[model samples]
Target: MAIKKDMLVEKYIEALESGTIPWEKGWTTTRLHNPITGTTYTGINRIWLTFASYLKGYKDSRWFTFNEISNEKKFHPGEKWHLKKGAEGVEIKKKSIYYNEVEDKWYNSKQYYKKLATLNDVEKEIFKDECKVIGDGKGSYYIFNADEIEGIASEQIIEVDSMTVEKMQTIIENMGVGYEEVMQDKSFYSPELDAVITPPKERFKDEAAYFKTLLHELSHATGHANRLNRDLSGEPGSMSYAKEELRADIGAAFLMADFGLEFDESHVQNHLAYIQSWAEVLKNDKNVLLEAVKDAEMINDYILEMSKERQLTLTQTMEYSALDINEYHVELHGCDEGIDYTVFDNTYRSVDGGIIELNAEDTLLMNDFVEFIANERLNIDFTNYECKKADYEELMEKVETMCLLDEEYARSFNVDQMGYYVSEIFDNGEVVLDAHEDYRMFFTKDEAEMLSKELPMSHVTDNSEFVEILKSNIVNGLQTQSEVNEIYKKPDIEVLKNLKIDKPQINKTMTFGRGR
Candidate 1:
């Protein structure tokens, strides 16, 4: 007996109702659209071009790209309305469509249309505007829609009641430091260990998952300050550290259970799987599930205790002061010839028409002076020092003489009390010593005659003294290098080569006694 068109439509609806629709084997029906008219058409010959256009637009948008859309139905171009056959075939108008694949007596598309027509006004609006009937045959069809359709299609209804803004603010205020602030010192902060809760940028698709991550971080914060004080001493990979991390994980789970935040079977399964893996690592034993549970329970208890205390404190009083830090600039100067110098004062005094001034304190000055001596004396390259090893102590001592001389002379002049006077000198000598203009008269009238007689012009004419100093420094550096080489002996290549050749073979066959 042959199935009627109306009976086939009824069978398709039955299949949909029974959840027996074979979506995986391709849609039993199809849909088509006219791109120029912007009108959709369904039944036997559904235009493929319309379906392709819709798919292209949906795929191109970022919002649609992330969503999962079912592709169970397909479309194909059909004959014009004038095309027809015999009486039964004539009944089959060009618009009259048949299930391209299977025509079941109880499953068809007309029943689905009737069911859709029965929906309430609001539901009907959602279905018509948001849902698409994707099918080709006159008797069978499939439906596809956005994620929003899940709410209507689902057997369960999820009521989303947002947490109050005031409540959220209170939680954050009481949550110690915010995650962003803590992250500023990233070297010390560990998101996994510290369990610092960070609010999601927006609500998540899975609300329970979002809360789980947040609660996990909150559990970590419970260990801080005066509570559990879980060895958050910033030592990476220690047993204590691992235990603390586990405590947070367990605490989060406990909190979720306490708050009545239900999870799907899949979510619960994932959690258990992760916990089981962690347990193996924590105990190094397969049968330690009970111990892990006990640890988790303890962490949960600790969290409850800490949370109560935080709430009490927040209710009593909230006092905080803002700290303001301002930076002040200090101008520094060197000698006239650009010879590096150090200033040992907090505030620099501007002189030489504001061109020269001091830098902040003795520490900076000492550092600058040390750097200058190292650059001038050691002939050490800065880049080499970064990559290669050098004796810092040796370098320090080598420049100690110059450092001491500068310090002593600056002290005698009470340079700290009355800022040192700077001057420029011009002379065609090994060292062009520039005397200050202000102090030049004093030098010429008060001490020039006596100093000139003691250290005559002939003494200034010699260049050998400076050359001798340079030669002595080079010799001392070589001697230091030789001493270092003697202490740490290099490997001997000849001895290693001889040892390799002289090794005896273990498997040589022994001769018989008769042969001997």
Candidate 2:
């Protein structure tokens, strides 16, 4: 019989759990071999997963490769594959499969699959015959059918090299542009005709130091009038202008990477040092390093795209709007503009209606906003609060306080008489109230009787305005009865009650007793 999609997915998940994946070799390092370069590298399971996700046929689901062995094999079987090298019609042999001891199954190697040529041998043959070389020299390049490289290699090529100070001076002279080096306090300047880049003379003590500075400046030039058309000629420190400076800095990193100049540990250290020094002045976020890396990668892609094509054009322009409000305007709306302002922790929204959009700037902003709102409206410091107590009274008190519960309800729990009740609380007042052992709390008479006629929480909200509501409803002013009914409504309440405490007696004497 053919396996269903859901079944296949379940099987894959089970394989993952069993450690059948070769990459999950307990604590041992995963060995990855690049068939083309004959280079071996070591990584963990997580890294292997990332590589597997980029393979050919498995692009949609990286869990399995095109060369995966059958499940019937029971044991993981290794496979060998040939990878073609550039220009040399030779295929290099490499191991592309291995058995996962944990999962007790065979899986393909992620690294080997990712390195496979995006184009088959036939596609390469077609491109080679249609394209021709153009320029000469280290930075010189060629022209090829755009269709061949459109989705193949990088969308663009970027050439980066260093030039001597004299060479730079000559280029400026030939362009007939006047320039001047700014004072020690200055960093960038733009003349009426062209922007002039002047390296701080004292900042660099040697030619290597000076060249690095010049390269950074030249990268900025690539974003000039006819190229990126970025208005970097504006006065310094303006919002738009400051953003341009950041873009230039990112551009410089892209250029450095393109030059094959290894950004070794020292280079990274120096860059980080500069970033740290500007942290205060630039209002740099210490946590934004990853975001900065992503921005740098985007800039690199753009630069490479420019290099690949002799001419470039942008087909469409997108516009965005930001609304500004004064205190009077905000008051007129009768809404606190900043009250609900929270950065969404995850901005990538799913198309399904389950996801809610928040007004936060970023994850950190959302976190701060959440805390701020909790403190202001809930009168609780969520950040400093902990749910470590196992006593029902202590846990309930904290929960009630954090959730803005009234005094009567908050004080109902008796720590000395019962064990702890602790679990997560949903925003809509639903709670997973788990009680610990050593607790002795019983429902009132009314609650026990109401339990027999209780409805599912979903049914209660099906026709009412209180969808997903969890508020208590009193019948005959009997609190115990209401509590017992609510407890019974919980799917796991019986199991939890059995584990933590004995069931209360249902005899008339106990049910009608005082303090019931």
For model 1, how big is the CA root-mean-square deviation?
Answer: 36.1
Task: Give the TM-score comparing model 1 with the true structure, all chains together.
Answer: 0.24
Model 2 score (lDDT): 0.32
Candidate 2's TM-score: 0.24
Write the residue-wise lDDT of candidate 1 on 310-397 in tens digits: 2111111112211111111112234332323222111111111222123322222223423443466434343322111123333333
For each candidate, give its TM-score against the true structure: 0.24, 0.24
For 390-432, candidate 2 gives per-residue lDDT tens digits of 2233223333332442233332232211222223334654333
| After superposition, candidate 2 runs with Cα above 4 Å error | 1-187, 191-193, 199-203, 233-236, 262-516
lDDT of 2 at 460: 16
Query: How well does candidate 2 score on lDDT at residue 177?
Result: 40
